[model samples]
Target chain A: MFVHGLATNPGWDWPTFFQFFATRTIFSALWVTVQLTVYGTVLGFVLGAVLASMRLSSSPFLQVVAWGYIWAFRSIPLIVQLLFWFNIAYLYKELSIGVPFGPEFVHFSTNNLFGPLGAAVLGLALHQAAYAAEIIRGGIISVDAGQLEAAAALGIPRIRQFFRIVLPQAMRSILPNGANEVISLFKGTSIVSVMAIPELFYQVQVIYGRNSRVVPLLMVATVWYIVLTTLLSIVQYYVERRFARGTAR
Target chain B: MIDVKGVHKSFGDLEVLKGIDLDVPAGAVTVILGPSGSGKSTLLRSINHLEKVDRGLVRIDGELIGYKRRGNKLHELREREILRQRSQVGFVFQTFNLFGHLTVLQNVVEAPVSAQGRKRSEVEPYARELLERVGVGDKADVYPRQLSGGQQQRVAIARALALKPKVLLFDEPTSALDPELVGEVLDVIKELARDGATMVVVTHEIGFAREIADTVVFIDGGRIVESGPPREVLDNPVHERTRAFISKVL
Candidate 1:
C-alpha cells in the first residue's frame, strides 16, 4: 500500500520534473553553483597554501596567526558566517583601499562592492581556506623528514627542494582529504539558498513553491548533486594515480 | 682536503662530539670506527656542516664550510652560500636517502642540472656513466623503491658522484643493507677509494676499514682515542679503549 501511495500520489508529478529538468532556469542555477565552487576552490587552496606555509614557518607569530585563523573559522557555524558576510554592508557602510591609518586612496559603498553572490563566494573561500590549511599542513608533515634532509645535503635550491622533492610526496597524502573538502564544498554551496541567490537548491525551492509540487523538484536537485560529485570523484582518482608514481608496489 | 678543528656539538644535555680535530688529506680514505652513541657519525656530519658545530669550524680547501671570515670575526653564511658550499661536499646516509619519487637516472641528474645549473644534456650522459660505474646502469629507469636496499645505496653513491664533489662523507652506508647486500656497496666505496677520491666513512665494518681505509680513527665517549694507519690503529695496541673496541668488532 505504501509503495502504491508513493507511486500514484498526485505529488509525484513526473511530467513537471522532466519539463523543469532541461529548462534554462535549472541549468542557469546549476551554472551559478559551479561558478561558486570553482572560484571557492581555486581561491581557497591558494590562500590555504600561503597559510600552511605561515603555520609551518619558523616564526612563532606567523604560526599563531594561522592557528588562530583556523580556530576562528572552524568554530563559527557556516550559515552564520554566510549570513554575516551577506549583511556586511550593515557592519561597514563603505570599503576602501588606502595606506593603513592614513589617507584613503579610494572608497565605495560596501553594498555596491559585494552583492549577495560575491559575499557568498568570499565567505565560502575564506571558510574553505581554514580547513584546506590544516589539510595541507598535515600532508606536508606526513612526508619523511629525511627526504628534505637529502635534498638539502645535495645542495638543491630550497625552492626546488620543496617543489621537486617534497610537494610530489606530500600530494600523495593531500589528494584524498583535499578532494573530500572540495566535494563537501560543492554540495555545501546549496547553503547560499538562505540568501535567495537562485542556485540549484534555491531555484528548486522557487519552482516547488509556485507549483506546489515539492517532492519531485527536490529530487531534481538531489540527482544533479550526485551526478556532479561522482564526476569529481572520477577526476580525483586520476589525480591521485599521477601522484602515486614510485610509491605503489 | 677537509679540516675539522676543535669541533664540539651537543644535543640538549648530552655532548655528542667533543673537541674533535682531524685532517683528511686530499685523495685519501679516512674511516671512523666506534660503538653506538660514540659520536663517530656526528664527527662525519660536522665535516659537511650537516650538524652545525657548537664551537670551532670546518674548512674545505681553505674555505669555511658554513661561514665567512670578515676580519677577525666569523659570520654564518646565508643559506644560498651555505648551499653552494654544500654542493662541493657529498653526503651518503645509512638509510639510502635516494629521492624515492624519481628514477635512478633522474636522481643522479637532478643536483647537477638544478643546483649547479649544468645543461641537462651534459648531466644526463654523465649521470648514465655514473650509474654504469656503480653497477646499476640497467636499473636507471626504475624508481628507488623497485630496487633492493643494496641497489638503492649504489644509486645514491652515483647520485653523489654526479656532482663531482671535492669530498664525500658516508655515514654507515652499509649498515642498513642486508648482510648479503653489504659487499656490493662496500665494493663501490673501495673502487672510489682506488680512484683517489677524498672520503670520510663512519662504519662498524672493521674488516672493510682495514682493507680500504688509509687511516683508521677509533673513537669512544665522544672523543677520538687513537688514530693512525689501519695496521697501527687496528693491529697494534696503543690506547686500551681502541684495543677493546677493535677486539669486539673483529
Candidate 2:
C-alpha cells in the first residue's frame, strides 16, 4: 500500500524530481560539495600529520601546542566553528603575512578574501584536523617499538625508517579510523549550508522551497550522498589492502 | 676486532653495567652468559652502541662507535653518521625483529640498499643468495608472519649478513625460539662461527657456547665473574659465582 500510494500520489512529483535531478544547477552544487570534501580532507590530513609528529616529538613545547589545538578545536561544535569563520570579518578587519610583531609584508581584507565557500572550507579543515591528528598519533604508537629498533639497528636512515618501516605498519591501524573521519567529513560538508554556500544539501533546500516538492528533492540529495560515500568506501578498501601486505593470513 | 673499555651504563638508579672491559680479537666468537638482570644483554648491546655507555668507549676496528673523538672529548655523532657506523655492526634481537611489512627477500635487501646505498638490482641477487645460505630461499617472496619462528630468525640473520658487518651482535637470538626450533638457528650461528665471523653472542645454551665460543665470559652482579677459553670458563670456573651459575645451567 505504501509503495502504491507513493507511486500514485501527485505529491511524489516523480516527473519534477527527474527534471531537476540532472539540471546544471544541481550538478554545479554537487561540484561544490566535491570541492569542499577534497580540499578539506587533503588540507586537514596534512596539518594533522604535522600535529601528530609534534605530539610525538620529544620537545615539551610542541606537545603542549598540539594538545592545546586539539583541545580547543574539539571543544567547539563544527557549526559554531563554521559560523565564527563566516563572520571573521567582524572579529578582524584584515589578515596579513608578516614577521611576528613586525611590519606587514602583505595584507588581505578579511571580508573580500574569505567568501562563503572559503570560510566553509577553512572551517571544515580546521575542525577535521583535530580528529585527524588523534587518529594518526594512535596509528603511529600502535606500531611495535621493536620494528623501529630493528630499522635503526640496520642503520636505515631515520626518514627512510619512518616512511618504509613505521608508516606501512601504522597505516594498517590508521586506515579504518581515517576512513571513518573522511566519510563523516563528506557528510559534514552539508553543515556549510548555513553559511549560504550552495552545496548539494543547500541546493536541494532551495529547489524544494521554490517548487514545494520537499520529499522528492530530499530523495535526490540522499541518493547522491549514498552513491558518493559508496565510492569512497571502495577506495578505502583497496588502500587498506595495499597497506596490509604482509600480515594477511 | 671489537673493543669495549671501562663501559658503565645505568638505567635510572639501577646500574646495569659496572665498568666492563673486554676485547674480542678479529674473527673470534665471544659468548656472554649470565643470569637474568645481570647485564649480559646490556654489555652486548653496548658493543653495538644500542645501549650508550655512561662512561667508557667502544671501538669496532679502532673507530669509536656512536662518537667522534675531538680534542680530548667525545662528541656524539649525528644520526646520519651514527647510522653509517651502525651499518657495519649488525644486531639480532631475542625477538626476531624482521620487518613484518616486507617479504623475506625485501627484509634482507632493505638495509644493504637503503642504508649502505647499494643498487637494488645488485642487492636483489645477493639477498636471494643470503636467503639460500640461511635456508629460507624458498620463502623469499613470503612475509615474515607466514614463516615459523625459526625461519623468521634465519631471515633476520640473513638481513644482518647482507650488510657484511664487521661484527655481529646476537642478544639471545634463540632464547625466544621453541626448544625444537632452536637447533636450526644454532646450526646457522655455528656455521657463521666456523667461517670466522667476529660475533658476540649472549645465550643460555651451555653446550652451544662450549662447542662454538672462542671465549666464554660469565657475568654476575654487573661484573665479569669469570672469562677464558670455553673449557676453562664452562668446565673449570675459577669464581664460585661462575661455578654456581654454570652448575645450574648445565
Candidate 3:
C-alpha cells in the first residue's frame, strides 16, 4: 500500500510536474504547439478549398486528380504519414524542379528540406486537408441548386457568383464543421510528439521521462487541450451567430 | 425581340423540345400555355442559354444566344460572354429564386451593380423606384424568407426590372404562390404588360392570360399546336389538342 500510495499520490506527482511546467522551456514548447496548430490548420484550409473546387470542377482530369489526392491522404493514418515525412530523406535523397525531362533548374537535398517540425506540420496539414476538402465540398453542395441557376440567369460572372452568392451561403453550412475541424486539429497536434518536435505534449513527455512521473504530466496536457478546445468552441459559436442572420429562426 | 428556330433538346433518350420554333415580336406579351412536362419551360430556358439546346439556334435581336457564329459552325461562347448576354434577359423563376441571404434591395441591385459594373449609388435610386413601383418599397432591407410568397414574387419582378432588360421571361411566376396570393403577382405582370414591356410568360393562369397576353401559344408534346391573338387562340382554337387543353384548364 505504501508503494502504491507513492506512485499514485497527486501531491507528490503534481508538485514535481508543476516545477517543470513553470520552467521557461515549457512556455516555448507551448508556443511550438500553438504555431503548429495555427499554421497547419490555415494551410490545410487553403489547400482544402482548392481541392474541393477541383473536385467539383467540370474538367474530368482535375476531378480525377483531386479525388485521388483526397482518397490517398484520407486512407493513410496521420501517425504513419508523419513518420514517413520525418524519414523522407531516406525515401528521396533530394527534390528538384526543372522543365519536364530537361536539366534541373533548382535542387534541394531532402535532408535540408524539412526538419522534425516541418515534417510534423506537413503531415498534419496534408491529413487535415483531405478531411477539410470533403467538409468544404459538402458545404458548397448544401447550397440549393436553384441558387446557382439564379446567379447564372442574373448574368453574374462565375467568380462574383462564387464570392458573393455561393460562398457566403456555403460558409453558413461550413462554419460548424470547420470549427470542429479546427478544435480536432488543435488536439491532434499532440501526435507530433512522436517526431520529438518539442511541442507541448513532447515537452510533457520529456519532463515525465526525466522525473519518472508520467500520470501527472499527462493530466497537465489534458488540461491544456480542454482549455484550447473550449476556446475554439466559443469562437465557433460567435461565427455561426454572425452568419445565421436573415435565416429563419 | 426573341427568335428560336429549329431548337432541339434532349435529356438522355427523352426529347424535351423537338425542333421547336418561336418568334416573339418586340414589345409583345407572348404567353406560352401548356400542361406540365410539355416542354414550355425548356423552350423558355433556352432563350437565355440556361439550358443549352442540342441543335439549331436561339437568337435575340439576330445575336446568337450562347454561341459565336464563325462561318456555319456554332462555337460555344466563353462563360464570361454568356453571362454578359444573360444580363439583358431577365428571368423570374417559378419558385421566386431570390438570393435568400440577401435583403430585397440587395437582390434588386445585385445584377446592375455586379454584372453591368454600374455604380451602386446610381443603381440604388432606380432599384428603389422599381421596388416602390412593384409595391414592395418598405420591405427593402428584409430578407426573402420573411416575406410572404406574393411579396417575394413582387420583389423578384422588381429585381428583374432593375436590369431594364431587353426581354423578361416568366416561367409559371404565379404557380408557386398561395391561391390567395396569386392575384398580386398577376397584377404586377399586368402592370408590366400595360407599360409595353416585352415578355414571354409560361403559366397555367387562364384568366390572367386572357387579360394580359397579346399572343397566346398552346403547346403539347413539345410542339406548338396553335398560336394567335389571345381572343382567337384562347376563345376559338383551331386544333383539337388546344381545344382539349383550354377546356380542361378553363
Q: Which candidate should be chosen as best, given DockQ against the real structure?
A: 2
TM-score, chain B, model 1, is 0.98
Q: Can you write out model 1's per-residue Cα lDDT over B1-250, one digit (the tens) per residue? A: 8888998999999999889999999999999998999999888877877788999989999998898889998888889988888889889999988888898999999999888999999999999999999999999999999999999999999999999999999999999989999999999999999999999999999999999999998888888899999999999959988888888988
Q: Any idea what lDDT model 1 has?
A: 0.92
DockQ of 3: 0.80
* Cα lDDT, all candidates: 0.92, 0.93, 0.91
Q: Please write out the lDDT profile of model 1 over residues A175-241, one tens digit for every residue.
A: 9999999999999999999998989999999998998888889988988999999999999999999
Q: How far is B180's C-alpha from truth in model 3 (Å)?
A: 0.8
What would the per-residue lDDT of candidate 2 be over residues A71-152, giving only the tens digit for each residue? 9999999999999999999999999999999999999999999789999999999998999999999999999999999999
| Least accurate 10 contiguous residues by lDDT in model 2 chain A | A240-249
Ranked by TM-score, top first: 1, 2, 3
DockQ of each: 0.81, 0.82, 0.80
Model 3, residue A196: distance off in Å is 0.3
Give every collision pair in model 3: none
Candidate 3 lDDT by residue in tens digits, A1-249: 887886676655767656665578777888899999998999999999999999999999999999999999999999999999999999999899998899999999999898888888999999999989999999999999989999999999899999889888999989988988988889899989999899999999888888778877877777778887888888888989888767985
